[model samples]
Target: MTEQHAFSSKVLQEDCLDYTPFLSSVTLARRRAARLVSEWGHPDIAGDVALVVSELAGNALLHGRVLGQLFRVQLILTAAAVRIEVGDACGERRPEVRNPAQDEKFGRGMVIVDALATRWGVVPRTVGKTVWAEIDLR
Candidate 1:
């Protein structure tokens, strides 16, 4: 099932998907984000946007899992850019690049996000924080 939020943040279109903090939810969020962005007429960036959502959602599940709390994945698309936001229930832990060694098997999600997105950052919310990335479609 899918649900949307009542938001009017900008001139462009927005879509939101909320899910339980589970390992499988990350893949769900990624697929939803790709479909939404493609429907919004930005198919070229669907893969990147999906990757960003996966990374953020995976982080939420792995690091920000709060009992009885749900996370959110939001996509905002416009003529020039597409913004993806993933909100989780943990606020204390912030996202950063660890610059792991080349042989490390993990710690590359955010690095991939940084390389794919034009800009990305985290915003602290009342209960948690939202990690967002914007990709230029121009």
Candidate 2:
């Protein structure tokens, strides 16, 4: 599968559950999604998608994760591009690109994602919004 990601990739999809207010699990899932894309012979692109997933997943957890609610991470790799989607139990917040000052030690994840992704957007979900990004593989 990884090889295919590197060479002639097919559609790739993976799901990971979001537990309590934690980040370790989501991080691993994003890496796995990257690995799947790498298998398709697109390690570089996979890495890009993985990073986006990481940031989005983190955002989902940080700003969207709520009490008694769970978040979900999904990665899709098509022939033309790779898409990353992260959904959480949020309904009152939004994501935007920010510029972090020199002293700031956090809050720059989305900037990186926005720079790498060819296209990105947000979609309304039952609970919250699904933040997504697409990276061209061709």
Q: Estimate each model's TM-score.
A: 0.88, 0.82
Ten contiguous residues with the weakest lDDT in model 2: 1-10
TM-score result, candidate 1? 0.88
lDDT of 2 by residue, 4-76 (tens): 1232456665454554558786667777778878886788777777878888888887899788877777767
Q: What is the alpha-carbon lDDT for the whole of candidate 2? A: 0.74
Measured with C-alpha atoms, the lDDT of residue 128 in candidate 2 is 80
Tens digit of lDDT per residue, candidate 1, span 85-110? 88988999877767999999878888
Pairs that collide in candidate 1 are none
lDDT of candidates 1 onward, in order = 0.83, 0.74
